[model samples]
Target: MHTTTEESVRGCPDCGSEIRVHSRFSAWCAACDWNVDPAPPEERPGRLARAQRAQARRHGEKLLTELTAGGTLRPRRDASSVLAYALALAVHAVTLAVAGAGIGFLIRGWGGFGMVPGTLLLALAWSLRPRLTRLPTDVPVLRRADAPELFTLVDQVAVVVGTRGVDAIAVDSSINASVATYGIGGRRLLTLGLPLWEILTPQQRIALLGHELGHYSNGDTRHGQVVATAYRSLVTWEYFFHPYSDVTLLTMTVNVFYALPRWILLGLLLLLDRLTLRGAQRSEYLADRMAARAGSTEAAAELFDWLLVSESAEVTLMREANGSALRGRGGSGRDDERIDGLWERLAADLRSVPEHERERQRRASIRRGHSVDSTHPPTWLRQTALRIGPPVPPAVVSETGRELRIGAELAGVRKTVARRILHDGYGN
Candidate 1:
């Protein structure tokens, strides 16, 4: 796909090696990587972030070793899992204790000065209360009646993965997809990012669905309501008790008083994170297995390849938005038509990426220990595990006509998302 014409080929500035221009990528030296990453490397993370990453990597490596040795992969109630649940229960108990204390203060005060502290304590308890995941109001929600074809495909995948089907689907402009439980009834919602969805082949799309829906059955500790809400409460406590940096003596004294509780909360948060880390990592691998089972090993592996290119996809989208804006400002294009065929152009660009460049990106990911997030193993490791694991035939298949219907269902929201990106710029 990347043809090297005289105009597109030049010697690298740093190593003097031949570099070929790519339409959607930076032309960098293959030998020296003169400009491979174009964007400046991100600033080093803080100490805590670094520590967390290190722990995740270590845990991921251990899991990978176990799996590669033919160890069974299933969620089990190990000591860490038990401890994690106990800690979550402890967190909830603390909140209840605080609420009881607040009630006692209110009863004892009965309209005296004590009422002030009672009210404050009650407010703190309210702030720390467990919260259910809520459906985002900003995105479009598509029910089964509205997008029967899409829901049907999702339902098929769910059956293959042995989980209950989602109650609704949410569409957004993000480059990722996820599943979450929302409301008191715990309804399942699948959020599809149109940018990612449009670029995927129908089978790849099924793989994406399989991966997300797989989370529901994979025993991800972080996704469970109790642990999730406990984490949130700890975050709230950390924020409230965070030390002020002001230099005044009064502020210093207040910080000293806040320091002990803040440290204690931080310790609990880290301990919970540590306890759940192994289970969280295992769940991701299990989800990947579910994806392979539902969509075939080939499609699942290709899905990870697509993920490796998502950063480039994001950069391309931003560039497209900027170009459209400049064209509008220069009167070279009508405002209404600025974003026309945007998704088409993006898919075309990504599909045209040459194999060599893809390999280069894969190698880059390995060198950098890149992952989807802290919870996931490195992309290379996941890909490797899929290859080493038992071969899986697709349990859920995509039909061409159904794929078309699903696209048709998403058409209107695609336009709205395009306009939002053009007006607000990418990554808003």
Candidate 2:
């Protein structure tokens, strides 16, 4: 997949040491980390941002310690959890109160100029109403009839994780996967990112599915419509009270009048964020355990290792697409042929990475406290937690023939995604 040559070797400017270049990655000195992250970190964040980061890191570390120390793995209904739910209910109550007031106004001002305020209040109430998550229409959605093998595999994993199987599977070009609920009935949807799927071993694929489905079994309240919609309502309130930008006396006076309410809303939003943060993080860890239970600890741990290289994998795909576009200028047929092999080349490139490089990336992740997001714990911690206990045998296995059938089912999606990248570029 990758071959070393004189052209691929260079001296690191910072350390003046030889650095071997990877075909899919930037050359950097592993010893000194020269150009490891070429772009500078963003400018110092605001005080609130700094505080939030600090709080998240503290929670992550605390949880890691508790897990590694033989503490309970399941989430407990602690005070924070109770308070978070109470606050969410309070948010819903406020919206209901606003709606009631709007209806009263509409009734009282039915035949007068007062109808304007009534209408405005009703509009505000409607805007704040709880919303259902909807299925994304842009991606390819495959049903049981279309991809029976894949759906069956997901069903097996769901059984292991103690959750209902997905209603449909969606394929996209991202290097990530997720499970979410949609519609008023809250039907489950599984989104599989083809880039990530192509590089993983079949068992690792099961691990990916296990991890996503585990959220459903883990009781992650953050995903519940009640809390989610409440958060959205707070965001809407903040937007409505946000200071105006127009440079005029009237605008300045209006901003001054709204400043107090804006600050109050901001406080509420931050409070809700903090209250939910711990439970969300715990859910992620519990989900990881479920992943281990479903696909085996080894497979789950390997999945995390793959995640560390996801950015590199994405960059390699983009580079390949760009190369295809450049070659297409000479002729169309050759570029089309190369585009067909994009996934194969990507899998080969990632699989061929040196162990030393993988270790370096893992260490770097620990140093930087890398995570998927603030709602999750550090990748290194998650990986470490998986290894702390005895290895688990997979409850569900991926058979070779079944895997091939699933691959055949996804062939059309793969081609469509490849062509889109070739034209629209990666991360479009």
Candidate 3:
């Protein structure tokens, strides 16, 4: 087995996998596929800058090791994190309250020229409000009868994780798994990306689902959105705070007074944002731990590792398939299963590559290492966290069981989801 290494050594900063040295000055990460190349010798960081960064990494590594020492992953309520969130909420609430009051005063003709300032402030507040940028998914929701076996597995995992059943479940063409809570209380939507599902065995699928549910169990989804809304509200004033404005010169001059304070407020909000994001990353670790405990630790790690391969292969398939369609090469017939066939071929192609070649591809997938702003921790950190306790025996449901229960029933649901994805993307 390949051994894991410390981040202090030659490891990819993004996912912490051992880096393959490409030359004297360049390297790549095998786990997340992040590329790293040193600047020209004259342009490299100074000794002090390098030392400071090294010390900072060591400090971060030390903190994670301590927090996760026992390996029974649990959500931590850090004082700094709580304070940051509280402050974010307070900031946004104050902004809305002030702007609303000002607008109300203007409505009543409480001030003449003052209404201009009120208009500007209220506009700024409205602009900064968190936008619902993520459009609703058009994929078909899977019902129990639609995929009885798969729904059974979801129910089983939900019980194990001590949560109520999902209100709705969906399948998508992307290689990701996510859950969101929306509408009135208790309404939740759990999305299972088919690309990720296809590459994962049934056990890993269970772990993956458990992880998504854990986000709910930990209340990360709703609380995260709450905190994010605060930052977005603050960001909205950016357009108004700039040098130009359509308002009267008097109002413009008054608004000029907000320039420095605007940047200062933004700075503080950004600092809080960093702390809040760190808390979010911790939340991911907690979810990963829950998935390991409720499902299978081994499978959880494998799910992330396999994503390195499957995600890239998925893109390749989509690109080629879309290209083929452009050439007027329509799919054979209703029985052809074009998307599924294309994915299978792509997956097979990836599997057939030499180990060395696979490693290179894996490294290419990386964007960068862990950052304070990322909601998820590095993949290696997650793997290490999940492996903390005594080994748990993995579940051993046979292929026959899986096939009779869920596998045979998924085709119809899968086709509907794929059709929706195609319609939404290509209008075909």
Candidate 4:
């Protein structure tokens, strides 16, 4: 939270007090009843759950087609994905046209029935509009020259996965490896998490790369991007369309009539959203399977478990290290040479969990099923999916040995990544 202390734009005009900026979208005066945020948040004029929603949705069936069913590993078109794409497109079209037509009509016939549909349509369109943009703050981009060993490893994984090559590679502070594609032309980008790279064996690293690249190869990336954007719009629409209005005689009547169509729009949008999530879930499973095939299912599965452990261990270590620095016990260069293997530390921390607790978590992982909003299948399900079919022979991407030859450089890279993560935290 940022608090203003001067008579600036952010300070309170009436009271001359500092305004408390609770968040980017809201602020308030502490001395009076001046709420910078609306009671109903007029930002209908505005604005974001996922525990593992990304993981749940990231896997699709195409990448792991051979492993999931009896066939050679290859990408297959998903009917649901097509439907999701179509629906997302249809949603944007209808919302925009409705907004234009409705607003034009309402403006011509203000304070009448036209106002009802017009306001609603405009709101819907506003809701459907994309409200979020990813801003890169801390994650650093890596050129081929910056990390030739890493880029070479990626090339090997790409060959093994048989995917179109990515245009750029970024080293992020996250513990998960991910890929992003932009524009209709599908300019591709890959993000490799320093945390994941810090501990994963060469085979596991290949698996990660293969899974991310598989999204591009399967053509799911393009469609998935549409659905993902549409899903966020759904959230925005809901906010704008919340059932609140002025309670006057005329407005009460308008509100009464507005109820039916609003609910109808809500129902329609929600149903379409289900299809989007379902397709994404399939994609996640497929991506997971692809990674497994590229490396080994065992390594892929272990990676997931390690991810769960890593998230916790990483936070703990960062906190402890920060606290230590605050107390003048250590910082920056103090442990620069000593903090590379976050995954190894994470593994050691996992061992501290009681055996029974570990057993319980394993059971829980298996019991977890497909999540409607998650991108990846449950860890247990991913493991099970790989085992049911004859596993693809692991691609002998012996590049790991070659990659490891640059271990000193890699270690320095890891230390830099860790420091940035700890110092800056993951920027939004």
Candidate 5:
């Protein structure tokens, strides 16, 4: 039996506060509530365990803070945002200068016409606002439950990653979700699309949300927007000053004048395209890793598959609108040169596995898969990733029948509106 004496009631040795010993081996401090125990014979927590516990505590605290809304965790993006804006603006200016200088030699009126188009392009580029300072607005929906569940997932992921809840979630029939952060000051908004709500399970959705949150947290969103804005400006400049339509018209008409210079400018446009596509592919890969880290790898893969399918649908829709000419825009053709080696390399990496071994792995993955990757890699490449593992965790599948039912109702509402508006408007 463990004995107790007046010594047992002595103050805690650790804090010099009054303590009561319940057992001979352990004492509890009344003031600090510190639990004191006899020194271990020889065993103690090692460094790794101590570090892990500390990490766990920190992670837990982070989650709690997001949930309760009393944490000091705001996205710290000052230097990166400034750098992104500066670099983007500088690049845009340089491109305009080069194009302007080139066109200046062609015009007779002191080269003022050269500057006109270039200045217009610069203005267009400057119009796309930075994503960090916009206020958020929630998308309205008849299905109230889906919104709350969506909030739950957002909250959970925000907690894990240590960020604020998403700024807004929007509903659209289009099967796509983009992670965007915009605005100038403290009013930055993060927006999500409703297509994600239809496609992703709660867990997978959280994983996806976590990826977006990662972009916001890492200041990647601001950087991406800057790049996109700059690229858009470049496109605007190209279209206004050196339009393909104008070049074609000039080739047919008496104005064979613009055709030769337009052909030369075409090379520059192609080069810019190649660079932009490469940058987009790399940025996508980084976002995928962020999702994987925050949630299951399976969810990332599923999300990728979903994205590929979604893109295919979008391509089909575009083709319907424009005709067969628009078909297979991203497949082999002029566009293939834009993606350059990315698709070919990804396809090789994914398709090189032996057939039988691949089939076995595919079967296993069907039973328990990794989530989707964010980037919509080549279709064949995505199929390979799917065969290797599930796109989402088994836990992500844990959804109540209620959520499924609600999702169905939301789908019905979407269809009803689309039938009345889109189907009628398009005369389909």
Candidate 6:
């Protein structure tokens, strides 16, 4: 009574019923979400053929993973760390000597000498620490159970990669997260900022964890930590030696002689900061590729955008707070607000530029000197890199799986190291 037509009915691969497919390569049955790709096109393959193919694929994957694993620890000789330490130490020492000379002048009841420099150095330490400075926290070690919402995502990803979850994830007030390995064969610590959690989505959070783990997996954590320790050791010396310096300027005739050395010290510190930022940005890019390779492009992109937003917000809040705090402090309120304004203005300028142009500017800054002072790359470059995907071979899926495994081992090592460092001491 009726004739079938191609427009009215299409062959259903699964149920073999006449059903319409709305899109090309529609693998799901309309009535059921039955996947169709693995279905045999002809007679089902015999057991022997399937077994041999499966075994060969598994063997090949194992071999590839082993080969790549060996390459992960290859030393990436980034000289920025060495340069930064040298610069920081030189600057710090000079600044301390000048401050000490001022102290010497004060002790001798001079018209001027020690009071200003002593006040400046003391003010620098007090104003910067805990609030504005990048000092490590003395808060109790944070357990995963304490912040289940944040740590769960980290743990889930670590589980997938086969690593023990982090021992503790710190929540700094800053807008960054960093992984540190104390020394050779030491424990690792992953410091997460409270601001970062507020800005990132669950998937993005997972991707970030993956990225950090990538650094650990590739032995970047250990290298970075060794360099960081040397830097910190120098800073400690600056703090300690400033008060003990030979600033016995018992004469007002010799005050200007010390200012030059102080200025040099400040300049060197700034240079070190810039160099550190450059190395950090490159490491961040490497982590981004690792995250993407693990199948989370969307997560990485979203995270990058969120980080940019958080940074913008932080800049805004710091400016507003500084305005209120220093309203009567001789307009040194201007100094506090200057850095905030610089970042806010830079972020605004970036918004006005085209995405690609902004990316070029960011990269150029890294090449000239490290413009990003955080432990992450610029958001624009990170987002752009995610769009490009990992540059590895097409067996990238297997590589992803392998990375996951390596990440797990690395995470376990990190957690163990972190516990030791936090509970014991860095030297221990």
Q: Which candidate is the best by TM-score?
A: 1
Q: Model 2, range 1-428, lDDT digits (tens) per residue?
A: 44342237888898899988766455678778776655434534554455566667788889889977888778566677678788889988998898888788878876786678777888998999988878788888998999999999999998988888999888999989998898988899999999999999999889888999999988777888888999899889888998898889999999999999998988887888788888888888888888888888999999988888887797788887787667664567766676678889889878877765687677677776777765578888888878887899989888999999998999888888888888778888
The residue pairs found clashing in candidate 3 are 13-369, 14-368, 14-369, 32-366, 33-363, 33-366, 34-366, 128-233, 128-236
Candidates 1 and 2 compared by TM-score, better number: 1
CA shift at 46, candidate 4, in angstroms?
A: 20
Residue-wise C-alpha lDDT for candidate 4, range 1-428, written one tens digit per residue: 11222222467777877754422223445465354323331111211124234334344333345455665434555675677778777767766787788779788886587888887777767767744334244567666667677667677777776776666677776667778865566567788877667667777777787788777666563345666677676556555556656678877776776678667666655556455555555565667767877887777766666654453455655754565356552655655533554445544554454433343344444433423224455565566666775566667454646876656545655666666644444332
What number of backbone clashes does candidate 1 have, counting pairs of residues 3 or more apart or in separate chains?
A: 0
**Candidate 6 regions off by >4 Å?**
1-75, 78-141, 144-156, 159-164, 181-185, 219-223, 236-279, 311-377, 390-428
Best-to-worst order by lDDT is 1, 2, 3, 4, 6, 5
- Across residues 79-100, which tens digit of lDDT does each residue of candidate 3 receive? 7677877877787788778778
Best by lDDT: 1
In candidate 1, residue 231 scores what lDDT? 92
Residue ranges of candidate 3 with Cα displaced over 4 Å: 1-60, 67-72, 110-137, 143-146, 219-225, 238-262, 329-337, 358-373, 395-399, 402-409, 416-428
Report lDDT per candidate.
0.84, 0.83, 0.60, 0.59, 0.45, 0.47
Where in model 1 is the C-alpha error above 4 Å? 1-40, 329-336
Judge candidate 5 at residue 62 and give its lDDT. 38
For 337-361, candidate 1 gives per-residue lDDT tens digits of 5566778878887887777578768
lDDT of 5 by residue, 80-180 (tens): 34555565676567765655554554454354665566555445434532324344332333323555655555666666655676555545445555555
**Ordered list by TM-score, greatest first:** 1, 2, 3, 4, 5, 6
lDDT of 5 at 40: 21
Candidate 5 global TM-score: 0.46
Overall local distance difference test of candidate 1: 0.84
Q: What's the CA RMSD for each of the models? A: 3.0, 3.0, 8.4, 15.3, 23.3, 21.2
Worst 10 residues of 3 by lDDT: 35-44
Runs in model 5 with CA error above 4 Å?
A: 1-87, 91-148, 186-196, 218-223, 243-280, 293-295, 308-376, 379-428
